[model samples]
Target: MAINYSKLFNRRATPQSQAIPGSGQVRNSAGGYSWEVTDWQRLDRFLILGAEGGTYYIGERDLVKQNHDAIIRCIKENGARVVDRIVEISDSGRAPKNDPAIFALALVTTHGDVAAKTKAFANLSKVCRIGTHLFHFAGYVNAMRGWGRGLRNAVGNWYNAQEPRELALQAIKYQQRDGWSHGDLLRLAHPKEVSREHAAIFRWMLSGQDELGERTVKRKVNCAERTATYAAVGELPALIQAFEQAKAAKGKGEILKLITESNLPREAVPTEWLNDAEVWDALLQKMPMTAMIRNLGKMTSVGLLKPMSAAAKLVVAKLSDQTALKRARVHPMAVLIAEKIYAQGRGDKGSLSWSPVQPIIDALDEAFYATFSNVEPCGKPVLLALDVSGSMGMAKIAGSCLSAREASAAMSLITAATEPDYVIVGFSAAANGHGGQWGGGEPGITPVNISPKMRLAEVVKEIEKIPMGGTDCALPMVWARRQKVNVSGFVTYTDSETWAGNIHPSQALRNYRDQFAADAKAVVVGMTSNDFTIADPKDRGMLDVVGFDTTAPAVIADFIRSD
Candidate 1:
C-alpha cells in the first residue's frame, strides 16, 4: 500500500505558524510568519513610522532596538546610501511628518562611517529645514553623540545659511522646541555674522533689545530712508516686532487689529486669549492648514465653529481647497485623527472638551477623500480584507492611539466610500496559544457588515464586537476562490502578522489567480513597522505599502485601476 503523504503533513494540523526554511519566509513579530522585507524597505518604514508606541506583540524599547539594529546594519554596509535615502524622503514630502527622516539622518551623523557622516553634514540644511527641525536634530544628536567639530560646523552653517528675513521668520514661528532653544544653539554654535543684518539679528537673539534700531546705517538714514531700508529686509522682522507689541496690548480691539494687520501667526498670540472666539476667528483667516486642523476642537470649544458662522464658512472653504491641501501636505491620516478627536468632543490626552460640529466632522471626512487626486474612482470590484486578529487589536499604529485593527477598519471606509463595487471581509484563526486548535471556532474570512455610507465611528464600533484571534492573511484569497468570486484586486490591510494560514498568503494568491482571475492583484498595507510582508517580492501583481502614508490611497487606487 502506498503511504498517504498528505495525511502525514496536513497543512492545518499545526496550530502555530509554519515558517519553511529556505522558502524566503521568516517568523514575524506576531506568532504568524511572513516573507521578510529588504533592509532598504525596513529603513523607509522606520524613517516613516518611528518606534514611538510599541505594538501589541513588541514593546517600544524592543521595537526601537530592532529598527535601530537594522539601521546600524545598513550603515555598516553603506552609510552613504542610507544618508541619500533620508534626504530623498525628506525632500520629496513622501512622509506626512519629517521628524522620522530627521531622526534617521541624525542617527547616520552619529553612527554612520566617515563617508556617511560627510554626506549627512552635506545635507543637514536639507533635512533640518526649520528651527523646530534643527532643534529636533539637536535633541537626537545630543542623546546619541557629543557635539564634535563636524556637528558644530554643521550647526553654525545652518544659522549662517539662511537669509536674514527667513531667519527672523524662524525666530518668530518656532521660538523653541525639544528643549533646544535658539539661545542655546547660538551660544554653542557661535556662528559668525555674515552681514550687518545677520549681526544685528544674532545680537538681538542673545539680548532682548532690538539691535536693528542701534545700527549706524539706520541712524544715518532719514525717516523715509529708514522705512525703505527696513522694508527691504524687514517684513518678517516687522511682523515679529508687531507680535511683541501685541503681547503688550491690553485691549482686545488692539490685539485683534495687530493680528490682522501684521498677519501674525497663532504662535505669536498669547495663551490667555486663545479661548476668545473673536480672537481665534481673526487668527483663522491666515492660519496655516496644519494649525487650522489642530485647532479645530479649540475653535469649536470657543464657539467659533458653531452652525453657519463665518469661521465655519472659512474652515469649510479651506478644507475644500485642493491647492491648499497639496501645499500644506495635509495627509488624510492627520485629517482622520483630527476628525475623530473632534467628533468625540474630547482628546485622548488632556482635559480639553468641546461639542463637535457635525458639519466640520463631515467636512474633515470629505477632506480625507480630497487629499487623493479627484481621480475617477477605480471602477473595479475590489475586496478589502482586514486583519482583525488579537495582535492587530493589541498593537497600536505608531503615533496614534488607534490599534492596527481599528485603523484597518477606518482605512477600509475610504475604499468603500470611493469604489462602486467592493466587499469588506476580515480574516483570523482561533489558536489561543498554539495547542493544536482545530476549526471549532475558526471565523475564517468572515464578512463584515461595513457599509459604504456608515460613519467611521459607527464602523469602528461595529468591528470592535467581532472577536480577534490569530491572523491568516491568505484566508481572503482562499475563501474568495472557493466562493467563486472574481475579484479584480485584493487589498489586505494588516499589521502583517499573518502566521495562521494553512498555506502562505503569496501561494494562496497565486493559486487564486490561476483559477478565478488571471490578472488579480493583491496589496498588503502594513499597519505597523513590522518589517515583514505576506506578499512575495518576486510577484509583480503584489504591492506592499505603509499604512497611513498620505500617498497610499492614490497609489493603491491607480494600481488597481490598471485592471
Candidate 2:
C-alpha cells in the first residue's frame, strides 16, 4: 500500500553531472534541457501532503529535507501560504504541538536577503492577523511560544524599542475584535510599546477585586463596559466600583446600554446575554439583516439562544424577498446553514423551527444560485470526480463534524454550483464477489450528472446515494477515455490513497492525454493530511491542492488555463 516517491521521482543514487550552485536546476532523464524546482515549490508540495498517517501514501523519505534553514527559505519565498499551512497542520490535530510552533517562530524571526526579508516581514504581519483573528487565540499563542529564546528576546526587543510594532498591533486588533479576557490582554501587552500605550487600561484590569463572587454574565458585561469607558478616561478605581455596583443592583438595562454604546466585540458578549430573549430582541432590532443571516448558526447554537419565532420569520422573509436577494444575494453562510438545517433535522428538535412554507425551501434553493454570482464560468467543460471509498467514510475533517465523504460532496456541490458546464461522477472499486482483495477488481465509476440549478442539499443527497467501496483514483480518467467524454479539465476530490487499480492515476492521466486531448489537465483536491498525491511530478499540467481552502476554486481555474 505504501508508495515511496523519492525512488519514484528522483534520480538513482549515482554520481552524475551536478548543476551550478543556487541554480535550482536538474537535467531531464533524456539529458536535455534543465527544469527548475524551487525550494518554495518543494515546500508547497510537502504541505499539501500534510503529516503522514491515516490513508496517505507519502513517507518521510518522499518529502523535502525539513530543517531550520529549509523552513526559513520556505517562509522567505512563500509567506502567507507557509503560515496557512502551519495553521492548517495545527488545526488538523494530527501533528505534535511543536510542529506548528516551530514553523510559526521561524516565520517571525527568520531573515533572508534584505529585499526578501522586508517582504517576509510584511507577510508575517498579515499572517499574524490571520492566526490571531481567524483562528482561536489559544492556538496562536501556542505557536508563538515555539520560539523559546527567540520569543523572549523578541518580546524584550519590542518592549525596549518599538520593534515588531505592526505585529503587536495585529494581535491587539484581534483582542479588540474578540473581546479577550482582561488577563489575556495584559499578558499580550507585556511588550513595552503596547503596555505603554494602554497603561491605564492594563492597570485598571489588574486592579479589579473578586468581590463579585463568581463570574457571571452581568459581571462580565459590566466589567467589559466599564473597562472600555474607563480605559478612555483613565479612571480605574471608579470604574471597578461602578462595575461592582452594577452587578449588585442587577441593573440589566444599564449594563445593556453600556454594551450597546461601547460596541463590545461579538465574542466578548456573555452567552447568558446572547441567550436572553429580551437581549436578542433588542440586539436584532439594531443589527443589519445581512449580519443576522450570517450569524444565524452562532445565534441559534444549542443553549446559546432559543430560536425566537420572530428571528426565524425575519430570515424567511429576507430569503423570500426578491428585492433583498437582488440587492445582496444570500451569503454562502446562509446556504450552508440552510443545508445543515435540512440534513441534520435541526429544525425538528431545536429551539428554532422552520415554517412549513414551501416558498422558504424554494428561496433557499435560490440562495445557492445566488452564492456563486462572482465565480466566473470556466471556458472549457470540466469533469468533477468524487471518491466515495470506505476510507473516505472513516475520518471527519479536522475541526469539523463532516466526514470526508460528506465534505467531498459539499465541495462537489460548490464546484457544480459554479462551473457552468460540468459533469459529476462518484468512483470506487466495483464490489468483489469473494472476500474482497485490494486492487482486485476492474476499474469502476458511476456518473451522477449534477445540475447547477439543483440545490446544494439536493446534490449532497444524490452524492450520498453512491455506494462506498475500495479506492481507485485512476478510475475517473479510465472511464473518461472509455466514454469519450470531451472535457479539457478534471478535478478529483479524494484522500489520494489510491490502491485499488491496475494503473497508477498519473499513468492513467498520461494515457488519457495521449489518446484524447494532449493538453488536458487534472487537479487533485486532497481531503486528508496524507502526503501521497496522484499527480505526476514531471507534469506541469497536473496539480494537488488542499480541500476546503477559500482560494482552491481560483487555483483550479488558473490551473485549468495553465496560467
Root-mean-square deviation per candidate:
6.9, 10.1
**Model number with the top lDDT:** 1
lDDT of 2 by residue, 314-408 (tens): 66667666556545434343455555564343463446542233344455666644543345556788999998887777655532345677667
Off by over 4 Å in 2: 1-125, 128-189, 193-197, 209-233, 236-252, 265-272, 285-374, 431-443
Residues 273-384, model 1: lDDT tens digits: 8889999999999999989999998899888998888788889889988788877778666787888788899988899899887778878878877775444568899999
Q: How much is 47 displaced in model 2, in angstroms?
A: 7.5
Clashes of 1: 2
Candidate 1 Cα RMSD after full superposition onto the native fold (Å): 6.9
Question: Could you say which candidate leads in TM-score?
Answer: 1
Clash count for each candidate, listed in order shown: 2, 1
Clashing pairs in 1: 32-499, 56-395
Each prediction's TM-score against the native? Answer: 0.87, 0.63
Q: How close is candidate 1 to the true structure, as a TM-score?
A: 0.87
Candidate 1: where is the Cα deviation over 4 Å? 1-16, 209-236, 373-379, 432-442, 558-563
